[model samples]
Target: MTPSVQSVETEDEYIHVRFRDPDEFDTIRTPDWAAHAAQDVSEGSEVRTGKQKDSDDWEVQSVLIKKQVGEDKARDEAKQIVEKIES
Candidate 1:
């Protein structure tokens, strides 16, 4: 699937890049939020999923992109996500 940007809601010092995943329900992989953010994503480029904490609960927190962001660029920002995770 070609990755595309989705709804974004920013507050104070945080910006969320919500990925559009339709079939995410069938596959659930809890990515390492901090590490993924640090190595792959850029600053202010926080990742968020629709997966919930529990069966009937909400997700814990949005994933983060640390140490890579430099002033927010669209193309560079897209490069900071793990496209595939081998389980």
Candidate 2:
């Protein structure tokens, strides 16, 4: 499952990201661009999926920003996309 971003805090040269669901956090040493981008992301706004590098450490592979939409609207859009793909 993808972990939802709960909060982000900067410390030294790393950014600490707290996550929901798994109830854990990871420290990321991101490039300057990514660090700046992280600051603008609101809590609960993005979902992160990654591979574990070691115990208590994760390497973020992708970050997905959540779009503002009603649940029903998102479901309808997903259905439409799936239908198009299947046709």
Whole-model lDDT values for every prediction: 0.42, 0.36
Off by over 4 Å in 1: 21-30, 43-46, 50-75, 82-87
Query: What does candidate 2's lDDT look like per residue over 31-51, in tens digits?
Result: 444333433532222324333
In model 2, what is the error at residue 87, expressed in angstroms?
Answer: 0.9
Residue pairs whose backbone atoms clash in candidate 2: none
CA shift at 8, candidate 1, in angstroms? 3.0
Q: Which predicted model would earn the best TM-score?
A: 1
Write the residue-wise lDDT of candidate 1 on 1-87 in tens digits.
435555444544544444544344433444456345534445445444445333543231333333333225433454345353211
TM-score of 2: 0.25
Candidate 1 pairs with clashing backbones: 37-64, 37-65, 37-66, 42-69, 43-69
